[model samples]
Target: MIAKWIKFQILDTERQDWTRGYDTARRYFDREGSLDVPYEHIENAYPLGRWLSDQRRAFRAGTMSSTRADELEELGMVWDTADTAFAENLAAARAYYAQAGTLAAPRHATALDKPVGQWLTNLRRPNGLGKDPERTARRAEQLAAIDPDWNPGQLGWTVDWQRHYTGLTALLEAGGTLDGITPGVTYRGDDIGRWLARQARDWTRPNPEQQRRLGKVGVKPAARPQKTAARTNTKARAAKGSDAFTRGVTALAQYIQREKKTVVGRHHVEELPDGTSVRLGVFLSNQKSRRDRLTEQQLAALAELGYHWTQ
Candidate 1:
């Protein structure tokens, strides 16, 4: 199955070169974002082709190494050498290259393209490229001297010490097990503690659903009624309206009486055995709106209140 997942491919070097040339030619066709001159014409007119041909000839003739050495000498480097200084420099260069390769390509390329002497100079400075054995030893000594009673794993100690000594907050933030410290765990500092406290506050605070549940559980206080126009006044106004308005009001009333039955509306009235009828208006008013359905608890409460069906 894994073998089926993998596929092999090969690059056509000649085709690649041809495609590159084609792209370069296309760039000249639309000179909005690039150079305006036609590269193909320039290649044909200038000694570019001849130069490339000569380079290929030299490569095939095994004269490329000698040519490269002469070019290096022109840059002020003594290529022909077997001395200790030469050997040491070569070793340092190789080590530097290895270290640079571990970095991102852009940074690596920048370091690699720097002058050899300049790069070597950078490696010797206090905050330089080369590793300092003496500094490493001194750090170890300082760590040992850092109040033997001060546990490195303690919350404030590591952060405070690292800040005072190295100012490497990034390294401290990217937590890991240091010497005498537990792995996959971080010390809780003031910031972390505050974060945890805020999270606790958020968790303890009631959400909408939780508030509704708490209301149901009789733990929360009853919600205050919204200030609304009296239903009696509304009904009185509807009754005194024009013919069209009266018809609309009648139709709405009929819709509420008929269609409201399909849903568990509070309009469902009940009569008691003592010949007393309870107005569903009270239950309806207690709800969000008369259109809202009654819960089982509300229904049971209505029943306990001596309510019976009354059409």
Candidate 2:
């Protein structure tokens, strides 16, 4: 009889603990509107996140009671966190597509306050969607519904090319004309004019599907500029001489000013006062290796910036 009484007391304590966890979870649900709490989250000094994780583990292990599971589900407890995360990211992607008209987001792009760019990039990797055939197909279908050309590589074009094309499409849809998109013109951070000029210069490069899409948007290949051979050669030499040197110096100066340091990563790009960008680190490295070829003016510029290869 004493042993029975002790067992009853232990069961009562377990019930109280479970009830307390449930109450805390309900409070969290009311505040956050979802039970998708971070695994390390705390609520009012309680380890609510760990408690929720424990509950999920218990449910999966078939140790949790049906009544308890039902109560938690009432508060929007999602057992499959992978599915929940995928759904949320899909919504964010859709939001991005609605605004950008394409899913070819840059690696640093964000949408709906989510890192949708990285998410899409990860999805593009092999087996990133999942190993399950059915699930992969479902996810692919959903993405395709948002933008048929979301995966540009599968369609024989680069993501950057698709990004620019989409930007052009967005411009056209907004009633922008082709003539107004000059070299300096930009849309959604894309240099529309420069890309159009390249497409015109190499009109035969893009596949038939790409050509059809361009045609559908009323974009025709433009005529190449006619230049005299002597003039072109002179300009080319000049472009390689003073202009390139000045641009590199300008970029290095800008980088030093902005970062308050001379150290630059190999991939760093510095924007110049003229709105153009230069790969300053690569330029500096190249100049340092070819210091023997630098003119007096170029050496003076580097000295002024406190950049000395000998040091």
Candidate 3:
């Protein structure tokens, strides 16, 4: 019994867990040309990926032997995959900004074969950069360096609005005139004339900063001519009401995207891209109270905003 016990101990010592894991990792590295294994990857029924993750955790905790860490490092092991991913995404963002002249891409947009627009949208969300405050600030600064207006939410504007504004800025700089930019005219596929008209029509809605920007670009509030003023009042009122509803829907959509929730606070005010603030909480409350009064089109619009109500 003593001799058999001694033989078992000798066999166990010859097959240490770390030694076996290292051998599998080395074989994987040789075959895949990389050590960036997925967490659930298995090789020859051995959990090579989990084993590598264990090694990384040990290294981070200062429990790994220097020899073992060095061996894994030699095989191109990525110590911090998050940092590596950020670097790659940043590169893609840079490429997008270079071509678009603005980083205000649609959520479905792509660049450099990367989903850079969605990445940017995610990063713009609260705590999107990271949980570490200092690290988040540093990363935000890096993105700011690429495009100071990358996150236009703080500027009280949507990405779509920013994109159109960028095109307008470029056009004006190149000697385009407001008069020549009629309704059918476009800039970078955006109807600049229609956008400009909206800005003028809703001139009182825009905040001071927006007003100043528009003023600098020679845009002013649309003047109401006295000749047909009485005749246009009713028509104007109907049009303005429609516009207000559209703005409210826009504000609600943006709120849902940023907050990732539909339950807005009672006093929650959503700022539209045109700088108008919608009292979303009150708006919703009023809408729900008069749910039966909503027209078919209005009901569909609210449903599209994910505000499905039983009536």
lDDT (tens digit, per residue) of candidate 2 on 1-311: 88888778988788888888889999989987988775546788887867887787788889999999999999999897565467667877888888888998887789768899888877875567898999899889889998888776566565667889888877777888887767877888889988877776567667788788888887787676676677988867966877888889888887887876778899988887778899888998998998755543465467456554411
Worst 10 residues of 2 by lDDT: 302-311
- The sequence of per-residue lDDT tens digits that candidate 3 reaches over residues 1-311 is 98888777875664487788888888988988988665546788988767777776787789877887788888888788475567667877888888778888767778768999889877866567899988788788888998998876666545665777777777788899988766767876778888788778767656666678888888889986566667688978868877877787788889988988879999999987777799999888887888665543565566545554511
Off by over 4 Å in 3: 1-78, 225-311
Q: Which of the numbered candidates is closest to the native, going by highest lDDT?
A: 2
Worst 10 residues of 1 by lDDT: 150-159
Native-to-model Cα distance after best TM-score fit, residue 244 in candidate 3, in Å: 14
Q: Report the lDDT tens digits of candidate 1 across residue range 192-217.
A: 22322222334333344433433442
The local distance difference test score of model 1 is 0.33
What is the lDDT ranking, best to worst? 2, 3, 1
**How much does candidate 1 score in TM-score?**
0.14
Better of 1 and 2 by lDDT: 2
